[model samples]
Target: MQINKRHQVSPYLVFFIIYNSQVGVGILGFQRTIAAKAGYDAWIGVIIAGSFVQVFIWMMYKLLAKADGDIVDVHSKMLGNLLGSVPSFVIMIYYWLASVSVILSFIEIIQVWMFPTLPSWILCSLILGLVYYCVSGGFRVVVGVSFLSFIIPQLLFIVLYLYPLKSAHFSNLLPILNHSYKELFDAVKSSMYTIAGTETLLMFYPFIREVKSSKKFAHLGVLFTTILYTISAIISFTFYSESQLKETIWPELSLTKVIRLSY
Candidate 1:
């Protein structure tokens, strides 16, 4: 297959894709997972995890920029034809699993929250079709959709955060560093998976318009996403106890429920 060398995406679009892809699925459950280790100090765990992810993103970008090709080509070159295939296959499987999991989770969320009567398969099919349409348009369309997804959903967050403020108990975040350092490290490592999508940079570097500034964009994107994740984690920790967080499957959404819009 001949590779098409098309116009590259803007840095903002790159940021959108990285942020949206990472934020999906994981955001709903991130607080509970971190609370398991750091208790009410989960926000610190999120910050530590975000920093680790930024480092990984930097390393992946450096490797890709040095390779002079997309991830598959670079892997084959670095690891040789046979050994390289192993990592490539593993990555392919990971992407496939992640895609399916995201789709299923979206359906499950919609079924529970919005369309209680709808069958799971019906919701899944509708979502899968939309994903297929976006994916079929190739990388540019997917990036465009990602940009839209990141912006629109974010507006609701402002309302969600505001409602919880009056009732929030700042004392919930006290007694910081109460957990052992090892436990905090483990929480950071686990939450690092939430920011894992930046690894897509390995494939995207070849498509980035300003390849010279790709590193800057990648780091900037990670920094922006880390801030968002940290804020959400902090809010969830302050609003819910460690046990309450564990009991709530979707802490952010649970927080949103407290906000009643009279208009």
Candidate 2:
């Protein structure tokens, strides 16, 4: 539980970690699932889901700060090591399953668009191997990777949005509150799963250099991602009709097809 200062990363990096965790494979196609339930009003659901994540982040910081350790430590404190391991094991299994799901989703995307002949197992293995190497290096190394992961794709994503904007039907978002409350809630529920990775904070809280100051950065990261996702959802809604979005698996990825460069 006592992490050496050398192993701890700066509080500011927590923003990148939070951002990196929350925006993964889910963002690519979540617009469809949410819009399916609440129509264009689904962007509202994204904001609602993000508000919930902010509260969850606050709860995590409070709990972790009290225990002065990660979730495993908190569990052990509450239920002795013997009983605590059960829930901890379950949590680890959940993380394992989630990781596999994300990896497989990403692999499927690659195979569909880039490498139809690539075997899933081989790609999966290579990805896991890279993950193992980075993780084995230590938490600081992992944090460094998270920082790069947050930084590298930003410009490309911004450019991808330009093409979609030109063809967008802004009227698609008109009748925003037309959906019933139940439908909007369903959209919120789905958006919650898409933006769910903020829980990673539970595992890394102890590794942060200044826990108190990091709290604000963590919240700010959530705020930024929330806005990004909302904009993405709105863009997809405006660019594709509701029915077309339902048929498109990766609306965000499909947006890239519209981009053309002049020589």
Candidate 3:
């Protein structure tokens, strides 16, 4: 399905969409899970995981450039319709699962932190309603909303992470290379699973105003996300002790609890 030229977005806009999608859900608590195995070494795992994303982004661009089509079309050409669409089905299913995971995580956060009395079904319905409204507006609306999501969070990131630095023990990040290579690799794998939405580029590639520029923007998105995650992991690990980190479900959120602004 070709996206009409009229509905397409600037290649630069791809950066924000990629930012919004990858930064969702997982970053909140991923530090704890990755650190569970590697301890403070998890920050290194974040850089390694981002490197994997860079390689994948490069590979995706090369493949799309060569195939000159979206993933579905490429699959159809390579595998007959029956075989080709199997991969598309798998990709769509991955998307659906990731979406559900993100939504459920946010609902859990609300339940635990804000409104224990709020019905999950009601929250789910409201979210689905918002999804429907966005879908009804078409892809442009989706992109616009995602762009705003990326923009609006800049202040929050600063407030949440920077303000906590006063109490953060940068010393906690020491003894960093203490973990074995295998431990680091396992942590990287855990982080990668959370960052897996980059495949979304395959679908939006056809809608880019300039394909080459979009590819660059896509890599930038990954790089930016990598830095963000890496720094976040460091902050979380530093702000919490090894045992505290293991016990905390959302280290990133915990950072916000310590946030202070000097008068």
**The best candidate in terms of lDDT:** 2
lDDT of 2 by residue, 30-70 (tens): 99999889989999999999999999999999999999999
- The TM-score ranking, best first, is 2, 3, 1
Residue 20 of model 1 has an lDDT of 81
TM-score of each prediction: 0.93, 0.98, 0.96
List clash counts for every candidate, in order. Answer: 0, 0, 0
Quick one: how many clashes does candidate 1 have?
A: 0
Clashing pairs in 2: none
- Model 1, 1-263: lDDT tens digits are 12356746766577787788688878887788888877876678788877888788877767776777778888889899899989999988988887888888888888888999999888888888887898899888888888888889789778888888888888988887888888888788778877678777766677777666656766777888888888888888778877788899889878977877677
lDDT of 1: 0.80
Worst 10 residues of 1 by lDDT: 1-10
Which clashing pairs does model 3 show?
Answer: none
For residue 19, give model 1's deviation from the true position in Å.
0.7
